[model samples]
Target: MSVTKALEGAVGWLTLNRPDKLNSMTRDMVETMAAALKAWRDDAAVRVVVLTGTGRAFCAGADLKAGNGAAAPQPGEKDSLDVIVDFFDTLRNFPKPVIVAVNGLALAGGMEVVLSCDIVLAAESARLGDAHSNFGVFPGGGGAALLPRKVPDNVARYLLFTGDSLTAAEMKTYGLVNEVLPDAELTDRARALAEKLAGKSPLVLARMKRVAANACDKTTADAIRHELLELRDHKRSYDIQEGLRAFAEKRKPEFKGY
Candidate 1:
């Protein structure tokens, strides 16, 4: 399998499994991951998700040597690039939080994956960059578009133009990474963070994600209005009432996720 799926408590773990290839994504890997995300989307048992890879790399990007896993498209059929784009759309729109654990190298399409995710935790040894320029290939993913939104314009330009890698610590300083840990501690720390998120009200978390995403491109006034509308709708949810009741009883809220 090019991708592996596992359930740990309320966290769903999706691992890129082709370490021999630096975990580069193939069309099959993208499809498999999309299917898993769809399955976990509505699964009440799964409240959080973690995406990572095996071996020395998180993902080096698409396998250029394999023609990026492209196959001839039949009439009315989508090709590899379409498949890759759709998978990224699914990931970005996932209701539950998706955390990325960067264990090593993440370049090109791999860096785009990090952009789509909700949070990123990296190992001290991890390195990330846009290597597409080096090979005269333009990024078809979020690398060209979303990179600037995540970091300063200058930083994005540096990565895009130079095709040089940045240390996990350096990326953190640029706001691309949330936390960095020792390589030996990366997996455990990521799992612990996922477990912590799994304890929250799934409904609340989903709403928060939706509202935040919606607000990102809006003006302050529009964003406030949007947030207010969402809050108004959320006031009627069972989770809200349960949370208040639990607070009154001085106990942990047993959120049912509405």
Candidate 2:
């Protein structure tokens, strides 16, 4: 398998497993990831998700060698590009919090995957960038859109034009990476963060993600209204009452994810 899925407590871990190839994504791998994410979406036991890659590199981008960046045919599936589009859509709207553990190099589509996550924890040795220009190909993996949103417009353009990679520390300065950890500790730190998020109220977490995402595409007034509506809806959740009661009683809250 080019990808692996595992669940630890309330956290779901998805790993790109093609270490020798820097875990470059193949069509089957993307399909596996999409299916795993969909399954976990409704699995109440999974409250958070962590994305990472194995070996020295996270992902070297699209498997150009995989049929010239075109995916081989799969039953009931469109072309590789379509599958990749769906993968990014799923990640964009994924309800649960997702943390990307950039264990090593994350180029082109791999960097896009990192951007799609809610939080990014990168290894000190990690290198990230959109390198499509270097190959004389343009980014078609939502990088053009997502990159600008994550960083300054000019910086995104610079990266796209130069096709230069940035170290984990440089990415952190751009506000893309949440933290840079030693390569040896990247996975552990990412898991710890996921565990911490898993301990929060799942209902609240989902609501926050929806409202925040929705707000991004709305006018300020509309965003405020949407946020208020979501706040009202969240107020009715059982978890809120439990949280308040727990606070008053000086005890830990037991959120039921209602």
What is every candidate's alpha-carbon RMSD to the true fold? 1.1, 1.7
Candidate 2 worst ten-residue window by lDDT: 67-76
lDDT of 2 by residue, 116-214 (tens): 999999999999999989988777678888899998889899988899999999999999999999998988898888989998999999998988888
lDDT score, residue 11, model 1? Answer: 96
On lDDT, the leading prediction is 1
How do the residues 1-258 of candidate 1 rate in per-residue lDDT, one tens digit apiece? 999999998999999999999999888889899899999997999999999999999999998877744568998998888888889999999999999999999999999999999999999999999999999999988898999999999999999999999999999999999999999999999999999999888999998999898887999999999889889989999999998999999999888898
Residue 86's C-alpha lDDT in candidate 2?
88
Q: Lowest summed lDDT over 10 consecutive residues: which window, candidate 1?
A: 63-72
lDDT of candidates 1 onward, in order: 0.93, 0.90
- lDDT at position 240, candidate 1: 95
Against the true structure, what is each candidate's TM-score?
Answer: 0.97, 0.95
